[model samples]
Target: MKKRSGAGLRARVGAIFVILAATVAVVDGCNGQNSIVGGACVTGYVACADQCVNTAVDPANCGSCDVVCPSGVACLDGLCGGPVDGSSDGSALGDGSSGDGSAGDGSFGDGGDGGCEPPFNRSSACGACDVVCVAPNSACLADPSGNFVCAPPCTPPLVECENACVDTQTDPLNCGVCGKFCPSNLCANGVCQGATPGDVVVLGHDYSSGAAGSSQAKVLTNAVFIPPSNPLRVLSYEQFADAAAVARVKSLVQSAAFGRTVVFTPSTTSADLASPTLAQSYDVVLVYDQQGGAPANLTTIGASWVTSLSDFAKAGGVIVALDGAAGQGGMPQLLTSAGLLAVGGHQTIPAGTPVAVVAPADRIGAVVASPYGVYNRSVSLQAVEPEGPNVIYVAKQLVNGTPANPVVVHKIVNP
Candidate 1:
């Protein structure tokens, strides 16, 4: 409180300065104990709890000193786990490094080129894609309805218009011309069908026959009509052995390399079967029609005939029959008698008024020639025995064109 001399004041001020220096040294020592030396800031060396640290390169904590790693590894957050192997160099299984497929192996993910298009499959280029059918037959023209059909110039004649071929026969826009579309209403297939009166042209005419008019019907080089048995012979129960029917069958054999004939037999005898033998002698018989119409006596066609027919068909001759006309009775009984399983038989298309006709697109059958009576023409085929291969040609308005509904049904015996 009193003012001292200059010397005394000097001494007192020096002492106060020393005390302040000593206090600073003690505070610094305590701080040093909790701090790190160089970069070894970790426990057991120079560290504190409740704080972040890097055990790596920490001399006091070499490998993992209190959650600290060695120098080689970096301290990620506060853990000293292990050294990171950053060498993902082209050795992984699904890394796309194999240069084959995608970045995934089929075991774990997708595989292959991811498609079945061109260069992928040995067959179709525009075929299945990604295991599913895709743009098939790029050569075919697609209808507006998304139906892809063969275009013009149907290759390998007789092939129907499909994905690879366009049937120019019935194409009104391209009749007889490859890719050439026929005018409106022009029917075409391999050949034209449904010619109007006098529309058909004969190769030769015979005016010599004064009363015989033309004395000749239009003939097709590749086509032949398949006629049924003459509806006569009610007493003998034998199919009418007409020379015309026989000659017609022979003509069919001569024309087609492969032929099918269904000959109705009322009474089976060695004589009645002679024609079928002749029919089979020349061409491969696809079918033999032995089912006669309602016979006067259904039970009299000797068992030998039935046996022969069955044997012949079993040897690959196609045998077709009506509902109950094949073996002295209906299909059920006839098939049993034939020693064959009746796979398919008598099912009739209920007789309906003729609505329209459908023709096979094959070269051998009737086809659309002209567009005159092509669409929605009412017509019907009387199916007395329904169980067979129901087939009909589209020809309602004219005798030349085929009818819509199936006119013929070739039932296959399952056995």
Candidate 2:
């Protein structure tokens, strides 16, 4: 009797399991429609990018995802044409894969600092008020297309070098880093020293993709001064800072090899910055003008670029940095990685902010024109002070007569 009862209970449990399975299938919708409770959009809204915004009314997300409206417009219906047009018609059209995710332009006040702003709203200067438009005609225009000038439009043979058109075959004022005059020696191949065709490899915008603002267009056209014998190769990118870094590297070469064999390459990405074989290939790696303000590729940094750059430095590869592009704002991470930026060493000041001279007899003082105007292009000013024993006060400027207010400094990477 006991055995019979156990068998009956097992049969009953199996029957219950089958019924539950059927109910679950019905709940999930077998006919292609989802099970809706309390309406699909009104209360049970699907999660979109960046915020908990209602895509039906959010301007950033008019109908589809990332389909943002202009600054003064609002999202209506399944489209965003002008100002507010029509209603949503009580429908939820999502990208289908819905849930809380990272910030996208799904709408305003959704999350992650109000998601995305309109393209024309560079008034906030990148929409975050981080960038300040100092130039008069440069009103933060959102370069609508890619077809823009990448190189200086100088007629071939008559190259435009340093704001003036000159023939590379014979030009001394703009030879190498410009003003490297030699009254006695003949100018050969733009070099005041040797005219022989040396290995001149340039990682620059001249050979880069003609993308608007990818690499600094000036850096490439200036290559004319590098001489005709050296091979010019560009390692460039589409972002401004990344491209500027490439220019910075080139400048480093210019500083060292002003009249020597000018071989240079710039890093357009973190991968380029941290190339494993970079130290082997290049004699000196210049790091400056890294990322700039109002950059597009902020979070897309490579993990090993800093390490790679540091390894190159430690391996005796020379690194020359002019501005804080590689020292502070642009590639502050590199400074930190190379042990240059310390707890109280990094200093920052506003652009054009006047500071008293502390070390006018130093190297920095020898180069700069005035105490003010340290950083003119960037809205925020940043710099790293000298650190470690080898850290030297090339030049120091003070804001309020204090030792901590150093404006110009140089820190050794390894020592």
**Going through the candidates in order, what is the number of backbone clashes in each?**
51, 5
Q: Candidate 2 — number of clashing residue pairs? A: 5
Candidate that would win on TM-score: 2
Count: clashes, candidate 1: 51
Relative to the unseen true structure, what is the Cα RMSD of model 2? 22.3
lDDT of each: 0.29, 0.37
Q: Kindly give the stretch of ten consecutive residues in candidate 1 with the minimal lDDT sum.
A: 197-206
Candidates' RMSD to native: 32.4, 22.3
> Candidate 2 lDDT, tens digit per residue, 1-415?
2344775555444433432332232222222122121111223233345222444544555555577877644343345532232122222222223333211113322233221233323322232212222222223333346311113334556655444666655565544333334333455665454322211111111111222222122222322233222322223333345564454445543553444556445454556665776533544444434445332233235234556655655543444432332322433343444443432223444444544334444332333334443333322224444344555443344446544444434433451
